[model samples]
Target chain A: MPSEFTSTLNSSTLEAGQTQLKIDGLQLNFGGVAALYNISLEVKQSEILAIIGPNGAGKTSLLNCISGLYHPQRGKITYFNSSEHEMTHMKPHQIAQLGVARSFQNIELFRHMTVLDNLLSGCHIHMKTDLFSSMLYWGKAQREHIQFRRFVEDIIDLLEIEAIRYQTVGSLSYGLQKRVEMGRALAMRPSLLLLDEPMAGMNSEEKEDMARFVLDINEEHGVTIVLIEHDMGVVMDISDRIAVLNFGQKIGEGTPDEVRRNPVVIEAYLGEEHSPYPLRSKL
Target chain B: MISGIFHSTYEQDMALRHTHAQKIRLAILIVFLLVFPFLANRYYLTLANQIGIAVIGAIGLNILVGYTGQISLGQGGFMAVGAYTAGILTARMGMPWWASTLVACFVTAGVGAAFGLPSLRLKGLYLAIATLAAQEIILWVVTHWKAVTGGVDALVVPNPELFGIRMNTDFNFYWLVWALVILVTFASVNLFRTRFGRAFIAIRDQDIAASVMGVDLFKYKLLAFAISSFWVGLAGALTAHYRSIVTWERFTIDVSVLYLAMIIIGGLGKITGSYLGAIFMTLLPAVLSNLGRVVKGVFPGVEGIIPFIQQATFGLVIILFLILEPEGLNKIWKNIKDYFRLWPFSY
Candidate 1:
């Protein structure tokens, strides 16, 4: 069913330079079933791009592919960071080193580590000193560690996670854990950040706060964001451009207003009771 | 203010300690270790030697399980390899003690690698079973190889010498073992701060995650096994030389279990805990033996009440500790110290 939705987007030719990520003709299959089929889309720099779809829509899979967790069998993922084109087919840490970072759908914070330590792990790829210096506690390693800590502390302060900084990540509340995950992603100093359902289980108030943080990150920090979200209201409010997926395929791509009136999206969400144009007012 | 302290350049922060209190404590510990053999009686000296040998084995096991997070039950087997090599080279071939010790360490390391090859494909319980098999095989070879190992006949180990001074006395052997234990413990402490140490911890926490983070698991795991085996082998060599005999029965599955028990009784991933655990477990039997003697002196029929009471006590102690304090005796020590440190405000 989702394969049919993605087939529609596969027919469109992707435009370049406007977005940092230009994914063209991406196809991924698990056994006999296609989890993602010919999904092509672009994410512009300094803009919040939302990928919205119903359950089992392969939204998380797209983020996983971009983060190098799962490599697509077909199609290319070309990302531009600081004017250099880089491929996402490399190792996850390699992608991170190239200034692209991602948070997981489920929280993957190092549970035993303190909140500060979890944030510190994100900076592991950027650490310059090797084992020798670390073991001996030599001058170079000390200086590099201090420098990185300062950078991490700045992000920690921005996220307002100072209260629980010393507490283990396992002890944190769900909303705080999500914020810590974001802080970890920010610690990489990423140019492109992919967030997989940042507010998946949050209360309405928590979602509002998260949406504010997301907006602040894009508008103030000028970081490119590609988020997979289920809440239509939040997606409609925050996203600069929206892409809708059904099953594993991209069914619609346009501005929020344009996607709102799309016939296929209407049918996918509310069944065939209402026409695509009236669903905008219903939303 | 707390952040400022932790914000020291990585080198400064990771430095074993920054305060004069720590320096003084270490100095006092060194002094105590140096004076212990002289002050203690022959029985205490022997107990110290056993603890020292166990400390060495614990350090080796720590490299595999603590630093690398790989479970291994083959340390006792590696120790057997070292013991047999030392026993054969010195007693049969008439090799110099130092040269034979070196050869024993290297040979055992090679044998350890042979067992480690299978570790490349296995992990957790499966890897543990593989090491368990190695333990059995090594014991079999040592017991059956009559020409070199003396088979069932215990191989007599010559008294080790340095500059023509025979290390035959309990005091002399105690010093040798203690010095080696201290050296190994210090080295292991430094090892954990290194890149290899981080790689091991990363693998332990999450292997797939570590691989994605640019760590080559197979290469590092093998390296961990080799280094662990080398140290364990050295302990075995020392053990053989210390006892002045090589008996296959001593390096049995029971000894392997004891080593695992020591690490578990210590904190799983800490160097200090390993040494502390080794000392505690090694001294336990001696303490129990003395207690048994006292009980027998007090009551004539007590020995008849339970023939294998010590063995039962050992198993019970391990179970009790595992249930009540899974973090082991090190946590208890830490808690006591913390309580003292914050005496007035202690919980």
Candidate 2:
């Protein structure tokens, strides 16, 4: 059973197999160089979907487009929760306010802030105290602050980061910083969470921990997760669905078993003899 | 090294002062501040007033430069706006000092926000250059617009009267200024405990991530400018009344650099650092001149060198502080406290 803190994170949950995010015929370019082209994808509610691709394959670009960090020149991205939110033209912060939270590929944390404060920052949209009230921090401001502090504590507890909660994020280990980044995203209470290269630098043990947290957040908390990962073993073991990209184009996408058997995915990515990923049979 | 703090409630845990010792020490400090003017003479009272005003201004700049990581060199211009607004309101219209000061803060805040608009596109050195333009433009307006500002003639400010009591003396102004300092300190310290404070620091560290986390870059950046300028404006208003005059010469670019030096040498992003830096920067010249008197007594041929020595010392000390400890005196003080805190239990 989920704790009270964990259960209250998402205000609403979608039924399984419902379309949480729909991206149709999206195209992005940088001064004539295409970063992504003709990409169409759908993320189901309460499922772990992993995007696997080589470097420069536009995996991170797609996540950025969805989070409103990058503007795709063409097509539309729709996020459906309580209602449909046309996310293409909205500013990054406006998208975040509509319950879309993302962790960066390079661990974009408030490095000088304490881990607890970094997580509280993720609760920015939820916090409602005005500037004048914040200056006099007593009454409603103090009440709101303490209430959110309690909310962030649950994320800290779930991520098993209570030991370093008061330490600066910059001073933490790389693996720990990645965990804190996830904790920060979790603090946002997002119904749709996007993760870019979440396990890029983590060791096997840390990757297992992160994978478990992702699955738990998806299954227990009912958050729809779309992640980009390179490790085939972890992706094949954990993800409910997988999407493959090559040279800024989607080549194949399916359940792990189907993607593993797809001739195109095998030819373009998986068939490389000196691949970084362990053999599929090893998984 | 100090332990044994247990909070039974979240409010207790979130308190600015965590321990009974902290509360008791704060009480003693407050009592001492109230009684300081009584113990000191006029010279010390004057110095106290200067430090008090500097504290407010330095804390304001720290909010912009130190906490928000937006470098602004137009502090002098913002202060000028505050002084002139207060000066014009009081001397020309017969407005109350309190109301004028309040109006001055708002006017300066508006001006500061207008200048901060450039920050939405510029950063680092480019932003610094843009804010320097703000300083130049405001100074030019004050200098060229002779009709309103009195240009070269300057504006004479009358002493403020509160409850029929004239606040013309250094002793009276010391209490008034220090009271505001205390209030500003509490407000800034409290500001950091909330989401606004967190968002400012987050923007400083990583702006893109802050935006993705739902912090509006433009709004928070401008809000920082407005709030920071408000306090600086308050300091300028107090300075006008305390000096009984307002002049464009007083709000020069050098004054802006001095405030920046205060925050840098005291400690960036720290409230206590602002206090320490203000006291240190304000007293450096006085202390240097006192030392100069002894030097002149020994050799009466070095009077011209003494003024140059004071300026050189300021630059030298700032460079030395940066090289030795960029965290400023706050970190050094913490190191000392930690050493004593764990004394005789060396591990």
Clash pairs, candidate 2, are: none
For candidate 2, what is the DockQ-based docking class? high
Mind giving the per-residue lDDT tens digits that candidate 1 earns over A1-283? Answer: 2232212211112232256788999998898888999999988767789998888888988887887778899999887655545575776656665677777788876666677666666666666666446655457765665666566667777778878877988889999999988887776666778898999999999999899988877776677888988888999999989999998989998999888889898778634445557556657
Q: Which stretches of candidate 2 lie over 4 Å from their true place?
A: A1-6, A272-283, B1-4
Model 1: pairs clashing at backbone N, Cα or C within 3 Å = A6-A249, A6-A250, A19-A44, A131-B195, A142-B9, A142-B10, A142-B11
C-alpha lDDT of residue B20 in model 2: 62
By summed lDDT, which 10 consecutive residues of candidate 1 chain A come out lowest? A5-14
For model 1 chain B, give the 10-residue run with minimal summed lDDT: B1-10
Interface RMSD of each: 3.6, 0.7
Error of 1 at A166 (Å): 3.5
For residues B1-347, could you state the per-residue lDDT of candidate 1 as single tens digits?
A: 11123534644544567665568888999999988887999888888888888888898888898767778888778999998898789988899877888898888878887888887688889999999999999999888988778887899989899888887578888877887777776656665544456556767776654544445567778878877887798899988888888898888998888899999998787787888889889988888888988999889888875448988998999999999999988899888866765567745
